[model samples]
Target: MLKFVIPAVALAAAASTPVSALEVTKTATIAAAPDTVWKTIGAFCGIGDWHPVVEKCALSKKGDKEQRTLTLKGGGTLLEEEQARDDKAMSYTYTILEGPLPVSDYKSTIMVAKDGSGSKVTWSGNFKAKGAPDNKAQEAIGGVYEAGLKGLSEKAK
Candidate 1:
């Protein structure tokens, strides 16, 4: 009887939980070495150099964590904080502090790995849609990845 009661309470509590995150993942392959790709995108501020939509990136520090404010081409700013980075692993994770993307609680990671004579790149994120439909939010982040990967591929070549 006690086991039944506890299980019922747990299920009731879980049913009351709110919100779900929408996930997005995108991948690309570039004809560059993994280490070279990491060098191209390793720095927290290096995104401004390769991301097509990012006009410039200004970096600041919040204690030990690094933050970057990206200036978009048409006039918008995206502020992000570095969560963790691994140069040897060719990966970095970050969270959005503020941005135009239609997402809340946004977190993303980009990774690079060697594939034959080239590099494979991946960008992925999870967030709950804010003020927009879920599909719209997905499209926004997906478009950013597509453009960024395209730019990186061109630059790496």
Candidate 2:
């Protein structure tokens, strides 16, 4: 009984511990409307068109899920899986399967909506830092989203 009780107490304590997740959000305003912006960036593999870092993108389907393999400009690759997409909402969500980014269990969403003067595009993600400080990981992902949004906004113009 003593052996089992000790293990049970330790397990309960471990279960009570808390874990924190890092998050980043970046938004941009495009000159076009939501429909036009969605047409430009709504596709699961469309990042190559608006993101400067993505040189090329190829999409594949395994079962019902869609996956995209992005070849980066300088010579790296990222694999992502599309979790959900809604054409009516002009939004899509995806998860990072494998990537060069210093993150793990990363899930992201990209959406376009109507702003006051133009359409707004938002890119946001939640993840856990992997092999890097939380701030460092956040900064890396934040920079990518910022650049991507900037490129998309300019391209839409």
Candidate 3:
């Protein structure tokens, strides 16, 4: 009885602990058609052309699994893999396999949709804080999304 009680109490305490999961979504209105915007940014490795912080992108494939290695301007690399893509929907989903971000289990999607005569682009992600506070991790991801969206808008213009 004592052993069972102790184990149950520990399990309850652990269950009560909060998880550091976070999500971020950022959007931009680009003055271009959805297809045009998608064409500009939709390639798996095209981020290097539109993202200001990305210096280059190296793409690889292994048995139908597509991955990209992004080299940032300040000299860090992020390895990511494409999980899904829909050309008709103008969206793609990807996950970070390794990176210097302040989060782990990171998965993200970028989508473009018709908005009036232009297009609305959304970049969103979900992850858990790693080696950082929740707010700081959120802020970091938000900042990246904001910058990337701005760059995409400029390029799509």
Candidate whose lDDT is highest: 3
Structure candidate 2, residue pairs in collision = none
Per-residue alpha-carbon lDDT of model 1 for 45-97, expressed as tens digits?
99999999999999999999999999999999999999999988999999999
Model 1's number of clashes is 0
Which of 1 and 3 is ahead in TM-score? 1
lDDT of each: 0.92, 0.91, 0.94
Better of 2 and 3 by lDDT: 3
**Candidate with the greatest TM-score versus the true structure:** 1
lDDT of 1: 0.92
Ranking of all candidate structures by their lDDT, best first? 3, 1, 2
TM-score of each: 0.88, 0.87, 0.87
Q: Could you give me the TM-score of model 2 versus the true structure?
A: 0.87
Which ten residues in a row are the worst by lDDT in model 3? 13-22
lDDT (tens digit, per residue) of candidate 3 on 1-157: 8999999999998888656668999999999999999999958999999999999999999678799999999888999999999999999999999999998989999999999999999999999999999999999999999999999999996
lDDT of 3 at 87: 97
lDDT of 2 by residue, 88-139 (tens): 9999999999989999999999998899768989999999999999999999
